[model samples]
Target: MIEEIDSMKNLQNEVGRNARLVGRILDRLREKGKLNEGVPLENGGLIKIELNHIANETVKEHFLEIANDNRILAVALNLFHEEQKKENPMPVILVSKDVIMRVKADTLGISSQDYLSDKIKNYDALYTGFITVFVHPSTIDSFYTEKHLPKSQVPELKETIDIYPNQFVIFKDSFGSNKSAVARYNKYTDSFEHLYSPESVWDVSPRNVQQRMAMDLLVNDSIPIVTLTGKSGTGKSLLALAWELSKVLDEKVYNKLLIARPIVPMGNDIGYLPGDKEEKLKPWMKPIYDNFEYIFRNRKTDTNIEDVIAGIKNIEIEALTYIRGRSIPKQFIIIDEAQNLTRHEIKTTISRVGESSKIVLLGDPEQIDNPYLDATSNGLTQVVEKFKESKLSGHVTLIKGERSKVAELAAKLL
Candidate 1:
């Protein structure tokens, strides 16, 4: 009983580029013998497909008067009214992702709801991958003295905390005590392990405890995937790039550093701009280049930005569009702005990770630009929630913004 308006023709035409799900729907329709020739099923129910025309001027005028800014919605309203006037009418609900369209439907006395099939419930209570627990001063002393403690020994931990695999914990010495230590819970060994304190990575040290936890997970060779969620200025991308370069250039742990980001625009598509692929991607990828330049400058290298870029034979930056159908192995892969991707896209991208490679997904859910996605529905959040308990994965939500004072203020106040 799916009804598509004629305005959807534009969407159908662009289906080849980014509508694999829509293409699946079309395939299902053809398999049911309902693509072009509407056929009746065994229960004497028939699927109908109709083209839109201006049969009722009154309905069209009313829709225009209500939804003048959206012609697609106007046409949809007209079709809904025409169907409502049928002899044996059924309940018709307009499902839409646009809030304004749903509001307009409500004004016109038509039923509407947000598209909720792919939405995650309880997104507000989503996992943060970190927790703070206060313990006795003696317990903290034992942790420092022994360097590790088994979960069975920490009786206080059971009262207030349910630790997940690889979850970071801040052990505070009661409420008013200033003594604190950071440790990661290892579910496999049932122990709290000490944090990795790297003096500096490319001259960039962790500015906060969360960032330290992020560094621990990022540099650990055993963990294959890590997800970092935070607002702008939280150094999610900066830390990822720093660790990636450190591993590839200094430690030689990975063969190459591969970075990819979805080409979703904040306003308009880059296709409308005039240029080929690389030229068009320059604006979108400028932040990556800026981080690279900062890292190179901190290294005290005697080379310009262009020369540094040209001399690096082990780094590759490309759009996420072409990453499908390829197996990426033994590389440090960073997917920046991962919140712009859907769950399907995230699964496909992660499946491409071959043996001995680590993938880091960095993005801010609040700063997503994709129209069809929200904070609770984006791929980054999905991955964080799904892999919260996996031994091979770790996640950290960076709260403090280290980019600058003004940037931090904007991220918080505005």
Candidate 2:
């Protein structure tokens, strides 16, 4: 136990070091005027970023091009567009490399792009874990019938497998393998029944095992709490919302669907953000609003957003702050940007869940907004890492962005 604690301490130190390096890179960008039009204050005071006066004309034009392409630009660009629209009719664009930024931008018809042209490798792929192997057609019997291959030669299984009488062998296969990849094996349904999806539960189709798991937890009345973690552009929030809507609107399983996300910023300070709390939260929650609008939009008729938002007390859009000291019952709750929350905050949020309630916390740890916590320390990661062994909990790391090929390639290459 002592050695394990020490190992965790060392890992924490290493993660902190990397986070500091990331902070330094962002600071350098701010100094070089690459981030936004704002200048950092000495005492964490008000920031003064010029909206129209960017240093490079080429970069500005590039931003304009991105805006023209129907991508939602950065927050600064969005603010600039709103401020300058009346004075000067310049196109608005958002510049960013973050996958969530592009996703949000495309949803809102704002232009956006990565400041850097080339894409970096997926960080998760670089981190080592249990290897997966795929077996060949005829090798199934050999793997189960014979002794399992030596632990060193065989790829380690990440999760427990249940074997039953006359189960099929499901082998793991990789890029390079002999006659077959790792051997295959199957389990019996007698021990634990694997749930299948209903044909018409608000277009709830699994398409894969992970999504199947998500759907199972969502549709089942027994499970009240579900948490999903993945990289940006994943269907974590989308799936949660879709499932919640299915329950509340389509099936009438729940009384209401309430969605809320944190209002944390990426960098610097929000001290100079003009206006009240609602105004401050508007920028952070724009993505949520955009999603709501997209889902509520009508193809045939011209319906405005206010009417859609007012359609039912059944669906509520709220901030995480307002959730404290409240008992939410008979409602499907989704906490987007949950990675920004602390352990205490998550606890508070979870405690508010009353009878006949389901809370789904969805966010990307890699794209965390909270500065004090890293990927491992944040509430979302802690929940996922700790609760993975629990039968009631499940998670999926989405690899594909079904948005567009450019967005997909950008996520991979740039």
Q: Pick the candidate with the highest TM-score.
A: 1
> Model 1, 252-271: lDDT tens per residue?
99999999999888886646
Candidate 1: global Cα-lDDT? 0.82
Q: How well does each candidate superpose onto the true structure, as a TM-score? A: 0.83, 0.54
Query: In every candidate, how many clashes are there?
Result: 0, 24
Q: What's the true lDDT of residue 14 in model 1? A: 28
Worst 10 residues of 1 by lDDT: 1-10
**What would the per-residue lDDT of candidate 2 be over residues 149-261, giving only the tens digit for each residue?**
33223333324343222111225434344443222121222222334355534443455444544565666665566776655655566667777877898788889998898
Error of model 2, residue 256, in angstroms:
1.2
CA RMSD, predictions in order: 4.4, 17.5
Task: Provide the global lDDT of candidate 2 against the true structure.
Answer: 0.58
